[model samples]
Target chain A: MDLDILINSLRNYDGITRKNFIRGATQILDETYNIGGRTALGFGDDASALDIGNDTLLLMAADGMWGRLIEGDPRWAGYCSVLVNVNDIAAMGGVPMGMTNVISVNKEDICNEIMLGIKEGVEKFGIPMVGGHIHPDTPYTALDVSITGIVGKDDVITSCGAKIGDSVIIGMDLDGRQHPKFPLNWDTTSHKTPELVQSQITVMNSIAKKHLLTAGKDISNPGILGTLGMLLEASGVGAIVELEKIPRNKKVSWDEWLKVYPGSGFVLTSKEENVKECIEMLQEVNITSQVAGIITEDKKLNLRHDNQEKVVFDFNHDIIMGIKEERS
Target chain B: MDLDILINSLRNYDGITRKNFIRGATQILDETYNIGGRTALGFGDDASALDIGNDTLLLMAADGMWGRLIEGDPRWAGYCSVLVNVNDIAAMGGVPMGMTNVISVNKEDICNEIMLGIKEGVEKFGIPMVGGHIHPDTPYTALDVSITGIVGKDDVITSCGAKIGDSVIIGMDLDGRQHPKFPLNWDTTSHKTPELVQSQITVMNSIAKKHLLTAGKDISNPGILGTLGMLLEASGVGAIVELEKIPRNKKVSWDEWLKVYPGSGFVLTSKEENVKECIEMLQEVNITSQVAGIITEDKKLNLRHDNQEKVVFDFNHDIIMGIKEERS
Candidate 1:
């Protein structure tokens, strides 16, 4: 329940460890990130923005389900495919337009179950599953989903846009419980009304349109700190955050709370002048948000609470995403 | 090979046979195809088209590599992920803008190699690989890619736009050989200059802008004839194609020739007024196209060559895509 214990647990978690490889992968992809002029924002962001002209930018992102997740429950894997990709676009403050999926399966039943899940997710999110390819005879079953959305060119949020002296805020929808089947996942959207969950995504759009944040990203598998670490690394900045200031369900312990992947949550940094407006917009859609830290020029994430402070991430020494957005 | 042998070989080829499951998926998806009220063309086409306002439309498509393909050469799978999606947009007479991928792998080496291939593809195609998600822990490796393109709404091509009296034209770039690992693949772009390959894709945009084809689709896993069958099903019409009129590499046998998945080939239909312009444009890009036959009201695909005409697909009993656009 203490700070060190929670930090160690999160750092050692497989979900957090798995993201280290992203740094290396981004290194190889570094060369061709901006091959064309259409790329407004490329790697190390929840969604890449494309300059589509006419004051509009296109947001694109893709997500693949873990093979273990598919093996455990193909239907849940299918549903999560939509959920994760949608979240990626939402984090960028874009209006999701449609989705496409590629599914490979050897069994008919598994494919059917995954399709059923996709159907439900599509209905809940109000986004169409447009077009995709299917492999009927793969040795293993896997599902990957990709999404596209649109946003005004001047109003897009990006991880790499975070700046020094900005206030960092953690916003989360805490009105939910951990999924019964997936322990590390905090289930919020499934139990809530579709209208409420969708409005939660739209509220971020309102925030972006109003220029309430300098930078933002969705909280994902690496959980809150891991997600913040990636955003800071992308922006080439660091932060000193108070662990006690972060919003929590209170029922979940500190260790569990820090690592839970909430259905709707975000890590954002903005000028102090805009924090109140940002918090108010998110609150309108059921997100509880608070300023937890201030971004600094030093490339380290320092955590503080109860008159005790510890270094959680030193980006210069330990790479989280390693990708500096301007370079990537 | 004799006509019967060639027909039977094309029917049984894995590239063509695997598509038989598409109808089953469409049936399951049923009405969810048009969720946002702007899907001009859905499931049974090379790519789905969405009306994005301002006399312009967005084209979206996704493709996943076969597991065997991924296992055989992960690099090629990654490269082809871009290749296939790009071709999908080209076939629709749209200008490709960008692509995103979903990659799942347990090993760092596999991920690295795939990213290398993707980098090569981006440089070659002159398009950017914008953003995507990675599942660092998976039981097996898989790569799925999705693409978006732009087209003028009035000039867009659709699989279901073929008229009863339209001319059937099968155009393909014949300047390549079969791949070493994947024998059924016609590897055209690998050996040629990127300028030439990119020009081939751009030529489709020219055709669209000039207002040419009645119906069109990229020739994918289902080869030429099966792809034609899908077009016919979508168009609510049939055609009798002269089997001899289809462009082919004489070095490959008839059986192998009919089933090869070409790098840049398309099955297109046009009214007589547009036939000359269509063939001329296709030839400018090294795609040898000829007027093969005529579309008919009879819902059947017939193949004819040298005093021998045979019915290849009887749509009354068989369904290639099983989707009749609009069901009118």
Candidate 2:
């Protein structure tokens, strides 16, 4: 594979570029991001956290289906909405409690299809879609879902806790095929049994409780490497990843695999001694894990594959989300 | 006011009609509404309550900005998004925690204005907008927000608990003017100090702890009588509400007042012995409270005015939301 070509493609990926606008919109609440002083983590994490006392942190997150996804396939969009949000909480090592959604649609058929997909997702994940609001006569169709979860205050994993020497591990479930319509979507849980899919989520909690990792994040639209770039940015550190070490499905090419949004995947950081345990725990749950890189202090994400080295994101000038870590 | 005209107008109101679709969408999850079995309350309430142990119930709710509102005034729609979600939790007597949103926008200027309005709302209500997802390029603009709050399990208020012989109390903060652009919006908290606005929210918690209100719901797009109709339907009971006894701002006409969505208003029911205490507590927060009616065994909402009474919503034929009460 040509390292420069792959780096260029990832750098210009719409998934990562669209995220650049987030910091600008969110900055308006900069002064009051922690308005009630209860926000334990805010703005830059998979889920913003509220310190609810009793040693528990309440994790809240939201996800909107891409407009194209809604137009191309409403059912898949609805199902992915639940999968994405559930993963957000799971990435934080939390037990997802429930979800609420707001759907705006002009067509009744589309709304029904979306709801059906959401139902399938809820049943598979075992998280209830408790309540939501609907706008029946909107000019266009859109679905937005938000979730709430709970994690022990001490056990909560965050993107900003990665240390300089931590091993950057890429854990992904490779036993999946590309979605029929949306090829970038790695369909891992849809074909698996509910018990197995749920175990994949709960394993993160086990890892967090045991302090197996220093930091973690779910691989989302930005893909594995792009997602790691966000984690490095939040941690105020850098990483030099061995692209060859990233586990692949073997059926998909390396370039495409790096950009795929997996149904069950994570970018985690752990101490050298804990790497074996972290990988083994993930393996038990069907998540293939690999020590792909090491965190650095240079504030740049460098890639080395087949003796070729290149920079994917140089935080000194480039930004993924442009949001710094917000601590309570 | 002509009783027939008033009843017909409210009965045919779009606000109440639009709600008819909610139950259809939510019912799809009927079998798995409590998938993990921790759901203390599900659909049909202002917020779903999850039994999170430790005498605490996690209250979650979501609301989408009206498409018309977003198209008319993006800023106001942004601010109202927070107000509505906060009130949902407050209606259940929960402590407002934090919120997450999903915004889809094709226009950059509108997105910025919405964020600015959200910032103002967060500061006014003292609840942080912790995190959210942004779709910078969508065909239409929409904002949906979800909130998480905590309430004592025993002290939680629900719309399904109103009993026969209970006093139907209407509590509303009437010291506000109609929004210049959106006449149907009674702008209350925008002009009040943060401390005063917050007190209005806290009073519900106090009332819930004191066991003053048997059931409660925040007055939303459905206005006063229509909102009361929903409460009656949920409780499987009815009410006889005296229009004149309902608290109102003298400046606004009766017909328009009955349809106005006040910024801070609620329809509540309580035992006769607790009416005085409930009203007093609300009055202390500048919310005018009055015993306007009584809950009855017959599942019909009867409105009385000038010694003449007319049925507004006959549950046997009319269904507002049409969702039966979901008890833990």
* Number of the predicted model whose TM-score against the real structure is largest: 2
Instruction: Tell me, by DockQ, which candidate is best.
Output: 2
Q: Write the per-residue lDDT of candidate 2 for residues A194-289, one digit (tens) a residue.
A: 899999999999998998999999999999998999999999999999988998999998878999999999999999999999999999999999
Docking class of 2: high
Q: Best candidate, lDDT-wise?
A: 2
Number of clashes in every candidate structure? 0, 0
Candidate 2 Cα misplacement greater than 4 A, ranges: none
TM-score of chain A of each: 0.96, 0.99
